[model samples]
Target: MKEKIIETSIELFDRKGFKETSVQEIVEAMGVTKGAFYYYFKSKEELLRDICLTYIEDLLQQQERILRDENKDCTTKLYEIVYMLIHNIRTRRKSARIFFREMRHLHEEHLQEIKAKRRAFRENYQKLIEEGIAEGEFKQTHTPHMVTFGILGITNWSYYWFNPDGEISEEKLAEIYVDLILNGIKNREGK
Candidate 1:
């Protein structure tokens, strides 16, 4: 029942902005009573908090696993991480949309918590970029922090327009992004 409410709320919240969605709408979508919702969550904001926490935390865990794999090189790890984000966007499009778009509706306390987790995710990317630089795989011209944001910005923004049913597969799109990151789009005259 709790999971039902959360899933239903995510659907509603994705379609209707969090501020626009009401408890009545959530319960109606789930065919449950308000009392049922109250039994699981104290308020609509609480449900939103749960959704944000679950989404970010799950991504963090996946990233941590990738980071822990000692066998993969920095370049390979970077590709896999980008693939993970793109694959997630492909698989969980609605949740991804809500995670990125509806977060501002959270109250200050919940917002802070989400921000901390988000920072952790960003740090993971920064550390990976730093490793790539240390190994001479990536150019040190840019700061790892800046490079991390660039990679994240490119991959994360795909949620807004990446078509799951489009002709391009997620794997191909990920490869394109990884290639773009590794090699700029400039055409070499002699090559």
Candidate 2:
């Protein structure tokens, strides 16, 4: 029941925006009563916080695994990480929308928690870029953190525009990102 409520809330929040979604709508959609929602969540804010926490926690765990994978080279692992994010967005589009677009609605403490998790994800990628630099796989000309944020900004914001039914496959999109970051946009003939 709790899972259904949360899942329903995610759909509502994603489609209607967090502020636009209300308890009545949720209960009506779920065919449940107000008492049921209060039984599991003290308030809508609490439920929103829970959703954000769950989303960020899952992302953190996935990133930890990506960093810890020893079987793949740094380059392959980096591309895989981006591909994983693209796939996640495609399948979990609503959750991704709520997580990224509705985070500002959380209270201060809850906001801090989500922000910390977001930082961890960025830091993990920055660490990977640093490792690549050390291995001579990436250029030392640019700051790793900036590059990491740039890559994240491009890939992460794709939730706003990316279409699962589009022509581009997740792997191809990831490769394009990887190539853009590593080789850059300049034409070889000019140089």
Candidate 3:
């Protein structure tokens, strides 16, 4: 029942902005009463909070796992992390949209919590970039912080236009992104 409510809410919230989606509409979409929703989530805001937490926390865990794999180099780890982001965007398309787009609807406290988790996620990627630099795999021409944001900006923004059914597969998209990150799009031969 809880999962049903969360899933239904995600669909609705993704289709209609979180501020626009009402508890009544969510319950009706689930074919349940408000009591059913209240039994699990105190209010629609609480549901949104849960959705935000669940999405970021899950990504944090996945990021930690990739970082913990000692067998892989920083470059491989970075590639895997990019792939993970693209894969998550592909699999949890709706949830990813809501997680990134509807976060403004969360209360101040919940917003802070989500922001902290998001910061940790971004920091973890920055650390990976730092590691890559230390290992001589990545150029130190740019600051790690800037590079981290560049990587994230490229991959995260894909949620807005990435079409899973389009010409490029997620794997290919990850490769293209990783290539663009590692090797700039400049026609070096012309130089």
Q: Using lDDT, give the best candidate's number.
A: 3
- Model 2 lDDT at residue 18: 91
lDDT of 3: 0.92
- Tell me how far the alpha carbon of residue 105 in candidate 1 is from the true structure, in angstroms, after superposition: 1.1
TM-score top scorer? 3
Q: For residues 1-191, could you state the per-residue lDDT of candidate 1 as single tens digits?
A: 99999889888888888999999999998887999999999999989899999999999999999999999999888888898988998667778788899889899999999999999999999999998899999998988898889998999999999986799988889899999998879877756
lDDT over C-alpha atoms for residue 78 of model 1: 87
Candidate 2 lDDT, 1-191, residue by residue in tens = 99999999999999899999999999999998999999999999999999988987888888788889888777987898888888887667888889988999998999998999999989999999999999888888999989998999988898888886799887788889889878888999986
lDDT of 3 at 90: 67
Q: Rank order by lDDT, top first?
A: 3, 1, 2
lDDT minimum window of 10 residues, candidate 3: 87-96
Poorly placed runs, candidate 2 (over 4 Å): none
Candidate 3 residue-wise lDDT, 1-191, digit = tens: 99999999999999989999999999999899999889998888899999989999999999999999999998899889999999887678888899899999888999999999999999999999998898999998989999999998998889889988899998999899999999989998997
Over 4 Å off, model 3: none
Candidate 2 worst ten-residue window by lDDT: 87-96
Native-referenced Cα lDDT, model 1: 0.90
